[model samples]
Target: MAQEKEIHFTGYEKQISNWTDLIPAERFTLLVLQTLTEVSKDPRGTYITNDRLSNIIGLSPTRISSTITKLKKKGYITVQRVGATGRYIKTRDYNHATLYTYH
Candidate 1:
């Protein structure tokens, strides 16, 4: 079996912990987004799709979309549309994925 990588968020833990209003699913979504951002090495933030998050986090795409909107409304995250002409994931177009960064 492959060993999982250990991730250290340094200061992010303290910041995220203070978001007590977040429910379990929201919190999990944030963690996953954080992980993706950390490993992506993209300063613009992580570009991800709801379907991908659904697959990883075991939530439906609709739920993932709702959670993201909630996070944005709560000032926990910011999103940017990087265009739809570049990149793709197998059968799906990459247009659905947006650049996400946590504040």
Candidate 2:
């Protein structure tokens, strides 16, 4: 078995602690948050759409939509649509890149 290696979180601990305080008690919030943190490699932000999020997380689009809406309303993130399409997942519809900045 490989030895356990120490992992560094940099200065994200404080922010994450605060996030727990920010997000209200709800189901799926933690799951969505973990996924967002994984995607956001940098502190600046990352581009991800609900469609892509659904696929990567194996959740239905409707579930993704509700989680996103809650996150937005809670001021956990700011999303900007970068495409003129109605969807952004791998579909036969228009494609888009959604910018997400975690707060």
Candidate 3:
């Protein structure tokens, strides 16, 4: 059996720090939003669970839930609970014109 590689929290924290400078203040929520968008875009139609999203973004599951709530309130994303599966839908339209020109 192949051993799973462990991710260091320090490295994850550094990565998040790098993104803070790159992503705009208004678009700070893009990390989680973009991840959900990309995951749903996959051909296999893989739906990312809250736990998986938290691990990917280096956030606690509670934080992920809170972020999701905020996104839904702002009409940025939608979540659907279907039977046992939870699906996250990204509703933010990507405006390339105003994307990252500021920074």
Candidate 4:
């Protein structure tokens, strides 16, 4: 069985309101919103590949990728930090890691 992780949203009120107002038409954006909310809590910063997010949210990786791209285009998030190149090697096959901050 996959161990479930409980996500507590602490710093996500104004942004929630902002996002809701800015992109009410994008329905599936909530999943991406909540997922980013969960990861944004890491003080050391965080990064999520589509595969990891797909596993956590029970969606296909393609969906996660598209949502991420859309979120970036919408300007709701900004890359705050990034890891070294090849950081995801021998892991999820991603080339690097990026930490995003919500607006």
* Model 4 vs. true fold: TM: 0.44
Superposed Cα RMSD, model 1:
10.3
Residue-wise C-alpha lDDT for candidate 4, range 12-75, written one tens digit per residue: 3333444443444233444444455455565433466667767866768787666655655665
Q: Which is the better candidate, 1 or 4, if ranked by lDDT? A: 1
Best by lDDT: 1
| lDDT value for model 4 | 0.47
* Alpha-carbon RMSD of each model: 10.3, 10.4, 9.7, 11.6
lDDT of 1 at 20: 81
Per-residue error (Å), model 4, residue 9:
3.8
Clashing pairs in 1: none
Each candidate's lDDT (Cα)?
0.67, 0.49, 0.54, 0.47
Which is better, 1 or 3, measured by TM-score?
1
Clashing pairs in 2: none
User: TM per model?
Assistant: 0.66, 0.44, 0.52, 0.44
Instruction: Give the number of colliding residue pairs in candidate 4.
Output: 0
For candidate 4, the 10 contiguous residues with the lowest summed lDDT are: 86-95
For model 3, name the residue pairs that clash: none
Cα deviation at 17, candidate 2, in Å, is 7.3
Show model 4 residue runs off by greater than 4 Å: 1-8, 11-18, 21-44, 79-103
